[model samples]
Target chain A: DAGITQSPRHKVTETGTPVTLRCHQTENHRYMYWYRQDPGHGLRLIHYSYGVKDTDKGEVSDGYSVSRSKTEDFLLTLESATSSQTSVYFCAISDPGLAGGETQYFGPGTRLLVL
Target chain B: EDQVTQSPEALRLQEGESSSLNCSYTVSGLRGLFWYRQDPGKGPEFLFTLYSAGEEKEKERLKATLTKKESFLHITAPKPEDSATYLCAVGEGGGGNKLTFGTGTQLKVEL
Candidate 1:
């Protein structure tokens, strides 16, 4: 366990309902990311935070929002869950380094089903 | 646009068999290439990071090598426990912590 954890290992929600997933890291990494894994698509980034209150959109950020209020916690919120949003979500954290590419440690992942 | 592509999509190997998975990438400036192993229903586990061409890294029965345009994850005498989806990601300079990932190659090992 390299200090990354995601809440609600599994979830089922109705379409149009608001839902939020939480990612917590004990490592205090500078970068945190949220990604969704679908059938044919690889893990596509949804949102990421470089620091507290500093976030940016990823390739697939529509309908999703992320907030990082503290160093260890990053929250991803779906304003209105859709059936197309049913997928496994993953959280990852990476340390800052000169390598320009620090290795990311991932959480167990959350399986979400929109019915 | 930065992109990564993994080959075969899926591979089946008997226990103790050796094989390699390929990852081809196109980026503006390559900063690093990473390899990860993911079990079903779990997040990806970091395996290795290759920062430059001609770089190679190894751990246990897995060896990762990188070149200017692609990378490879080579498994030597793989075991049943080595069965998992092997993912490859590329990080580009100036991308600001963004990583582009490939679809991944799912490896199955049977005893």
Candidate 2:
């Protein structure tokens, strides 16, 4: 919706396989985040990057990892995919101003199905 | 712990019906509250941002109001095109500037 774009719009993988979802933002905002959306859980934060190589875990960071080697790209990796990990993944970007509040823009999302 | 909860998980309305969606939340220290509209198979689209309890924002057919403990999204004379899932999130003061989200309320408007 913003200038964000997620790669592999849809994918299906088997259990124990490694998968990586890519999120690229043209806005070049200072913050980037990864989130997963399920039927009843809504969107749960997975990881976020404040700057290049500066990453941190979020509410639901277990079984997942993230890396940001550049300002425009943030990647989420599933070391070993599980059925529980199957969900729609979204990437978001934000610029937190001096007021300490921000409205994040989101990417189209990548739907992953684990078998 | 900071958390968010939305009421009426789903809604069905007739064209021109006016209604309100509720988002209740508790945060460490609220920085802002946000409202988003999401269509099926798509990412969320930003709607409004409310900073203080007395603040209110408006779009064409939607109005958002904030309070100390919750926020409300009011839809007036909604059209079928207004049907979509509305999501609410809270921004807390932190280093990473992350947002905590609610499950969302799905709205269906039929003509």
Candidate 3:
């Protein structure tokens, strides 16, 4: 739960359009991540932010970019939407300083559809 | 590169039936192994994080055990509510924060 929420719970856009998904966390955790889940591919990280204004790419960051200007917010942007990019996106915050470190708490997810 | 594989792709269990889901992983270094439960149309919910071999964690009717090469999520007496996709992921600590995940095991429990 981690007090996380993602905006635009469901969206449909045409190919080549730019899309952005927002991930907000109230836990104020230092680490936040964006991941996409698809059939056969499970979940693949798109990007992550270790601190405000510090972002890094993940395994499948080719078509996506991210920004984190504040501690509680991380945004993932798809430069150009493609049918192949259509998938369920999830937001997660790492529970650092806890007994179970590196364990991520995920949001409800946003379903994006590209036509 | 690290790799994860979950077996039985899908499983069907009746109420009160007990079973186990397997997650096999190969990483350069094992930092933490995590288990998650995801329902349809929702993101994965964290369940357990095992740090080393022989370590185990439990929550109600679910128990997770980790070994050198694999982890097992055991269900002691599942109910219809227990039906969901179980996910396994592993981290190679100190290298990066990305956790490689398996495709997951879809479980269906019927009454």
Candidate 4:
């Protein structure tokens, strides 16, 4: 569906360790986003990139960082993983220039666990 | 602050049962309202987008309607395959493609 795929569908890491999740898209959309889903807290935006080398913080950007060096790849990194950071992370892409383009399609998602 | 609240955190219905899920929101300037269906272990899939009040969109057994303060997702004769979590989100003016989401309503269709 949107040619979006997230690597490391499931992962387990200990606290204070470094972890990075990857999102790859084939549609070459102008925008890509990262979100985390938790029990009782729905999905919250983590970060997003509009284009190569352009990125912005989201509602829950603390403890996380992202980089976009190419149109097809977006990466999210946790500086030091924490138990509280364990959750399902999702990648979404959208193209505002197309018809009904505001709609964001999502990737399969990555489940991360911090021990 | 833009906020969205979905009612009845969870619902269970027998096959062919009709029901409706509610989504209420408050935003400074409403740009768009979106509905998505998320299956277990998967990401959300776009369902509908309502730009203004008094608008309605439908696909198969699902119909989405929007008003000034709320939106409703109505299901007609749902099948077991219809079981999934429904999410509602709102895009506010000047938000720059960002959306505020509700917790979502989980629906389970039984035989």
Winner by DockQ: 3
Candidate 3 per-residue C-alpha lDDT over B6-63 given as tens digits, one digit per residue, 9 for 90 to 100: 9989999999999999999999888799999999988898899999999999999999
CA RMSD (A), model 1: 1.2
Of the two candidates 2 and 4, the one with more favorable TM-score, higher being better, is 4
Q: If you score just chain A, what TM-score does every candidate get? A: 0.95, 0.95, 0.96, 0.98
Instruction: For candidate 4, write residues A1-115 as lDDT tens digits.
Output: 8999999999999999999999999979999999999989999999989889999999999999999999999999999999999999999998866888778899999999999
**Candidate 1 iRMSD in angstroms:** 1.5
**Ranked by DockQ, top first:** 3, 4, 2, 1
Using Cα atoms with residue i matched to residue i, what is each candidate's TM-score against the true structure? Answer: 0.97, 0.97, 0.97, 0.98
> Which residue segments of model 2 deviate by more than 4 Å?
A98-101
| lDDT for each candidate structure | 0.91, 0.93, 0.92, 0.95
Q: What TM-score, to 2 decimals, does candidate 2 have?
A: 0.97
Q: Compose the digit string of candidate 4's lDDT tens values, residues B18-52.
A: 99999999999987899999999899999999999
Instruction: Categorize the docking of model 2.
Output: medium
lDDT of model 4, residue B93 = 80
Instruction: Kindly report the TM-score of the first chain in candidate 3.
Output: 0.96
Clashing pairs in 3: none
Compute the lDDT of residue A35 as modeled in candidate 2.
96
**Cα lDDT for residue B43, candidate 3:** 84
Winning model by TM-score: 4
iRMS values in order, in angstroms? Answer: 1.5, 1.5, 1.1, 0.8
- Evaluate residue B85 in candidate 2 and report its C-alpha lDDT on the 0 to 100 scale: 99
